[model samples]
Target chain A: MYQELLTGLLNGDIRSLARCISLVENEAAGYESILEQLPGNNHTKVVGVTGPPGAGKSTLVNALITSLLEADKSVAIIAVDPSSPFNFGALLGDRIRMGQHFNHPKVFIRSMASRGALGGLSPKIIEVSDLVKAAGFDYLFIETVGVGQSEVEVAGVADTTVVVVVPEAGDEIQTMKAGLMEIADIFVVNKADREQADIFAKNLRLLAHTKHQPGGWEIPVIKSVAIQNTGITDIIHAVDAHHKAVTGQHQRQLILLADRAYQLIQHKRMKDINKQLLMSEIQQLLEQNSFNLYRYINESSCFTQRGKEGKEA
Target chain B: MYQELLTGLLNGDIRSLARCISLVENEAAGYESILEQLPGNNHTKVVGVTGPPGAGKSTLVNALITSLLEADKSVAIIAVDPSSPFNFGALLGDRIRMGQHFNHPKVFIRSMASRGALGGLSPKIIEVSDLVKAAGFDYLFIETVGVGQSEVEVAGVADTTVVVVVPEAGDEIQTMKAGLMEIADIFVVNKADREQADIFAKNLRLLAHTKHQPGGWEIPVIKSVAIQNTGITDIIHAVDAHHKAVTGQHQRQLILLADRAYQLIQHKRMKDINKQLLMSEIQQLLEQNSFNLYRYINESSCFTQRGKEGKEA
Candidate 1:
């Protein structure tokens, strides 16, 4: 069954691709084998669109998708919602936002939940995107809720990352600037039709231009009314230009690859230990007067003397 | 020096207490000794105040501190900002918000920056709060920015968690519900003087009452205009009530302690390895094309066969 799904995924069968993605999402049995067989280095330009909630990320993504489709590029979107419980609410909202391209043959969109585990989201996104990339799309756009920490993780998987903000996001801009400055390849001041749009755009441009980014690439702050489909062409242009400039930066690529590897390996190391079981064990241990977490971990199989076991393996 | 600080902490000497907290926050050498020496099982109530930016958390905290002081209770406030660069910017903001209590003899306030290491903040908060509890304060208040995953973590350290939100948070209230509901022991609809305040408070009460908490204690939603000091006393009353209600829930205490221990152990396991070193090693491995992260991690001392090393040590 896994082999059939793998073949179907490789053959660009949507049903097979969807089923495989679900298996990966659920971490179902045989998922590891599927990941091991995934084809890498597809040269698919993964563009990350991230910003605060209500930054119209979905609409901007929809507009960006329309433009990419116009450029004769096949696009696959992984819309990531940082909400927990893995419910259908956020997915429904994202679907409505990008409803225009629901039937387009060249476009595919998927919504994901964060699943509430630390260091878990990145590897999951990378694995799913790998499946999508293996299916032969020219461009992959990963749209994430650009609150805290999520954007930084999403940056690892994307060649170019676009941070979207609105005119009314005055206070958030300040709070987000510290973290967002380092990861953003391009900045978009969306909702340019709203009040304070010009001032917000100006402020963003000043901030972006003053920041000294490596690779001699100047981070551009583009103004857009994504709902009305204005300024998206400029965003696409910036993404392409930035991609071209960053292509020769071997050090940057090394860092990105290292980050990807770090999360992937961390996930693998943690895969065997069931957190639920560990919690129960820890609870039992806590009942004892001398329960120290470090001592317990040092004694547990999770961090046990692996040298002997590792050597044997 | 560590011994002296530990002695001072136990004796409730303010200078020694401050120095020890700094040591723990910096994770300096000998800080672990100080943590190990910290007094446990103090009757000090640790209350966590968390909410989105602009939710008036600092102001609410200040009001609560004033009320606690009026009740003849000594209070210690630890303001944790989940921003990087670990600089003085956010600390200054927090200080200004709580400036009125700067010279109050019974009030102790300190600001913290969330240094960018994953899973670092929780352990640090727990350590600092431990120090504060050791100092014999009647109440310890921890205020954190409630944008993302940070609040859930901060909740682990608090016996009763107060989540503050303003009426203007229309859509965000819904989005934050899933995460906030699980952690909030008391909800504060601050800025109750504003439009829709009554409705927002009613909605919050409805939501809070509907959620099935582990403890039979029903979460109370209080309305407050914190700046005006309106409804602040009711918040204090609710906190005291919740604290009294949950004091006998041994299972809840076990879960909280388990979370604390998990973060501490995780930090300990990750402490010795430098991220830069790991990245460089991974970079070299990635150059070989067939290099996978799992193989590299398994080979590294970070996850090496600990059994051999354990016996030798």
Candidate 2:
């Protein structure tokens, strides 16, 4: 079934792609089987775009998609919006600005709600991005909800993260102070037609000059009028340049690969142990109104020294 | 040790209170010892105040403290601020605004950094609140980092949550749509001296009238000019009224007690389990490269089953 789903996804069937993504996002019962059968076709260049609200992220994404399509590249976009706490439903309206790209056959746009997930990206976003890649897209863009420190985490998960900013979001340098500067492979000053755009761009460049980035790559500050599609071609070129530079740098690639591998193995073993302990602990808490179930679980687990300490103490 | 710490806290020693709080916030090595010895002396009414930034929350808190102090009541305050993600340090400047109360023996204010905690409240906030209660405070107020949804969670952990808002925050009604209204025991339309305060308050009152609140409690919209200390007495009276109504209503009190018990149990159990699992998983992830660590941990927990299952199939 998993192999069949992967084959269907690679065949460019949107329905198959959607189903697989839903499965991945929902962690549907057979997700592991499907993931196991996924072809290791890492052709897609995943770009993550994130910034504060009103930074014209969606507009910039639309412009980026236009450029990618002009180069005959198939594109997939995942726009994440914060979910409503009461109903756990996402407004998913961040992509409303990108309606023009709706009918474009080569552009597949998916809107996801962050769903109370603290990490700016939804838990299933990585899985769904993989599904999009499996569906034969050349570029996958993941956009995060526009607030908090989680944007850096989103950037870390993607192959490349594009940090978006506008002119009037407080002092231009102060924007860098909030952890956004370090994550950007490419810094975009969106709404560049606005007043202070040049000043903001200069300030960003000066800020970048002071910091020594890993991999010895310079963080380029590109100005763009996303709505008018100005400097978009240059932005695309910069993105391409980053893709090439990072892919060519063996050391960075090795580090990323090692990080990804480490994440995967740790995830698997913990998942196996947690599945057995979590529900029982939750039930015990409900029944007894005590957090001691964890101590009980720790005592039961063969690997925990804390369990031995608990018994001895 | 926990009993000694509690005794120190009750004696109003800042050093002991700080030490107790540090244990709670960090889940420090001796937390279990501290928690185990805590007596059930919850005499302080926990009131949570939250809203969007620039909604005059700190000013409102300032006004509320003055009103409470006028009634000869002792107040303990915890102000949460967003921490710098890079340094994990908080600015801790909000307390500066409430400096008038610094010299007041009856008012104790502490600023807490979110400290990269996922929830708006740090893990040890409840424990700290407990300490404050044991220390003989009449009121304990928790002010959250004013990001909308997360603030609601902070409010939930309190006995009565007062949502503060201003008129110019655009679509005053829409601000409530962010789930602030549901959690609010009382709503304060602060900065009433501003142009649109009356209209905003009326609209909020109308909205409250239309909505069916649990406990059948009317969420009063009190218009206040915190700078002038206007309408503060009424706000405090409203809060006291809320406390009385809840305490008088048997069902409501039971529900609240059950909720608190559940939270206590959940925290205790999860902290234990999380400590054991997090260390091993962090270690394993450091060692391996193939596993999806996030997925493993998220899927391993029963709490995420519905969310995970919804995606995987």
Candidate 3:
């Protein structure tokens, strides 16, 4: 069954691709067999669009989709919302914003919410993304909802990362968490028609310019009114420039490749260590004198020694 | 040095408690030693307060503090903001909101951020909460800034979890995420003086009443104007009622106790599996056709084959 799905996926069968993505995302039975057959490095330009919620990220993504369609490029978007676990309302809001792009044959949009998946969100996202790349697209856009460390994880899957912000987000310097500043290859100040937009854009440009970059790429700050269909071309230009700049850096590419695998491996390694077994062991141990939380955890086979050392000691 | 700190902690020394909290929050050297020396289960009523950003959670906490102080109960607050990684802006904001209680002899406030800790946040919080419990406070309040799985993890450490939401949050039925609904023992309609506050409060009451409760405790919904100190007493009453209702449920108590240890153990297990090492190994394997993410992860020593079946396989 999975072989048929994989062949269909590689042949650009849309229904097969959608079914396989859902299976991978949900980690259904036999998902591992499907993942094992996936090819490496499909050479798709994976652009990550992330920003604080209410920063017009979906609108920006919608406009970018239209622009990409105009340039005669096939695009697939993975709208990843980690916040939807808190509220499905935001996910619904996102769909409404991108509603117009649903019918375009050249555009593919999939919305994912981290509801049932607790410790597995990142791995599922990476796997589904790989499947999407295998299905073949000229460009892939992945949009995440928040600006926390989770956003940093999203950057691992993206070749070019664009951090979107609005005019109001500029008032407080503290709002731009350090992790967000470190990963941004391009900055889009969206909602440019709003009050204080000009000042916000200027301040953002200055901040991006002043931010120390150990790499050679100069981060471009683009002013965008995504709702008005303006400044989308500039963002495309910035993305192109970043792509060209980073393509020559072989070391950075390897690091990104490693990062993509890191989360998947870490999650997979942790999955077999059952929480129920650990909790049962802990419950029995709590009544004993040697039942210190730290000691017990440190002495676990994974952390310290295997069975031989444990038995000997 | 830690001995002196531990001695002061047992004797109810304030500065020593602050210093020890910093040490534990930072996971400094000898911190686990300090944790080991502390007594277990000091009978502190730990209440967790959590909500979305800009929901005025800190102000609600401030009002609750005043009520608790008036009751003459000595209190220690662990204001756990899992959002800020930069210079302690949210922590400072929380302190400012609770400024008046800073000098009170019976009140202790400490702020914790997720800075420098990625997967370690929940375990550190659980360990620190245990330390605060050992300090002989009548009550402990743990507050978190964002609505994510991290907040749910924090709820594991609390006796009663209070989720604060404003009037605007009541409009969408989809706004209440599943995990939040499950953990909420009490709900606060904060900022109840706004235009739609009354209707919102009624709607919240309906929503909470409709949710499933396997534990047989009716979740209470209280309205509060935290800035003006209105409806604060009702929240306290709700907490008391929840405590009385759940005290006899032995199974539930054991479940909560196990949850507190679960994260600590999981984190400790993952800590020794270095990402850079795994990534480099994965990079090497990616060149081989047989290299699969899931297969490689499964073959790792931790996940499987550490003990019983390895010799046979």
Candidate 4:
């Protein structure tokens, strides 16, 4: 079954790719063998588009896809929304926003809910990204549901990260955590026809440049009105320029690889912990009226009582 | 040192409160002893106010504080923002928005960063919440920098969640994942003077009630121009009403306690798996041509060599 799916995946069968993603997402039996067999280090150019909500990310991606298709590039989009496990409706709006690209032969669009990871990015997303890359897409756009915490994590998985914003976000830019500035390769001041667009764009450019000068790769801030499909060609050009700029930055690439590896290692170590078993266990403990979270974890054998920090018996 | 701090903390010394929070946030030595000694399950009424940005949460929190103080109630607020670790400026805007209460001895305000949790919440917030509850305050308000994924997690920590919104969020509400409705105990339409405020409030009331009939709590949809301090009294009354509704719901309490315990256990188990160590190891592996993330984690001795899934030999 695995061999058949993989052959179809490499041969660009969409059904095969979808089935493979589902298998990896659910961590089905022998998913590890499939992931390990995927070809290593493809230059598929993973680009992440993220910003605060209402920043027009879906519209921007629709425009971006149009420009890429015009140049005859195949694209796979992983739209990640941090949603309720119960709410499968997260992607319905994306379908409406990018309706033109819904059935396009060269475009593959998939919406991934933030699967309740202890942190922001699901471990499955990294595996799915690799699967898509092995499927031989020319570009992979991982567009995130722009909010507070998940933006930086998305950057770790992408080669080029685009931070989108509007003129209304000018005040917020000042208070932004500064990590966004470091992660972004390009910034788009979308809805650039709005008031304060030029001023916001200029200020953002200043902020981005002041953060770092990595390999003299200057971060460009482009102004676009995504709904009108304007300034998309500029975004595509900037992406190409960024790809050229980071060609030999081997050390930086290694760091991102290490970050991904660290998350993978930590999560895998937690395989023994089943939350259902834990909840039932804790319910019994709480009835004793002495349920201290700190003390309980320190004494519970399942959670590091094998002893770190030398505080345990 | 902890003994003196505990005495001061119990005596309601503000300096001691700040120091205790820092100690817990850092997980300083023997801090678990302090937590173990603290009074268990003190009724401190943890009310979390959360919503999207531009929704006037801060202003509503300001009004909430004023009403609480007027009735001789002391309030401690923990503001959680998922900001960059590099940016300390996340709280500066909070300070200005909540300026009058900043220096008020009766009101204690603390800002908590997300601290780059692999998920959206820091485990530290739970510990800090427990610590503040021990310090003898009438109310503990956890005001989240609400955008997306973190909102539901905040709900798990809060006994009563107040989801604030604006008339503008009406469109986004239809597409919202059902989890928000489940978590919110109260919905506030802040900036009710804006266009469509009444219609939006009516729709939200419908959405909030349709999801569940929890103890017949009747989730109230409040329309308040928080800037004008209108409707603050109604929110306070609704909170009081909900408090009475949840009196003997021991099962619900047990579930929340278990959830918190689950997070505690998960983080504690991850203590010895340091990222810095993992990075050095992965950097070396990347130098070789065959570094599959899946294969490395599977074979890596630090992560699950003891083996639960039986996939490993």
Top-DockQ candidate index: 4
Comparing 2 with 4 on lDDT, the higher-scoring candidate is 4
A1-313 in candidate 2: lDDT tens per residue?
6677678887878878988888877767767776665565467888899876667787888888998898999999887765644322223454566888988889898977664322122445656776787788888888875454346556655788888877753321363344576677888988888777898789888877766666777989899998899879988888788887787555455445444433343233233233334344444444553333224433444323322333324
Candidate 3 Cα deviation (angstroms), residue B304: 13
Q: Judging by lDDT against the true structure, name the best candidate.
A: 4
Q: After superposition, how far is residue B118 of candidate 2 from its true place, in Å?
A: 10
At residue A78, what lDDT does model 2 achieve?
A: 86
Model 3 agreement with the true structure over B1-313: per-residue lDDT tens digits: 4999998887778888888888976668777788777765466788998865566788988888889999998888887765534425665777787889999998998876642323335467787787777788888899887533456666678989998877663222334334466678998878788877888778767777877565678788788889999989999889888887777565666577666555564454444555666656765665564445555555655333342232212
lDDT of 3 by residue, A1-313 (tens): 4899999988777788899988887768877777778775465788999866677788899999999999998889998776534445666888887989888887788977632323434567778788888888878899987523456667777889998877763223334334466678998988788787887778767767766654667778888999899999999988877877786465676577666655664455445555666656666665554345655555654332342232211
Give the top-scoring candidate (TM-score): 4
Can you list the residue pairs that collide in candidate 3? Answer: none
**Candidates in descending TM-score order:** 4, 1, 3, 2
Over 4 Å off, model 3: A1-42, A51-62, A81-122, A134-136, A145-153, A161-231, A245-262, A274-313, B1-42, B52-67, B81-109, B115-122, B145-152, B163-234, B245-261, B275-313
Worst 10 contiguous positions by lDDT, candidate 4 chain A = A304-313
- Candidate 2 lands at a TM-score of 0.70
lDDT of each: 0.74, 0.65, 0.71, 0.76
Give the per-residue lDDT of model 4 (tens digit) for A1-313.
4999999998888889999999988888887789988877677889999976567888999998998999999999998876643334445676687888979999999988765633334767788899999899989999887444467678878989999877753233464425467578999988899877887888878787776656888999999999999999999999989988986687777777877776665566555566666666677776776556667666655443223332333
Candidate 1 local lDDT, B205-296, one digit each (tens): 88778777776788888889888999999998898898898886878887787667656654554444467777778666656655444334
Tell me the RMSD of model 2 versus the true structure.
7.1
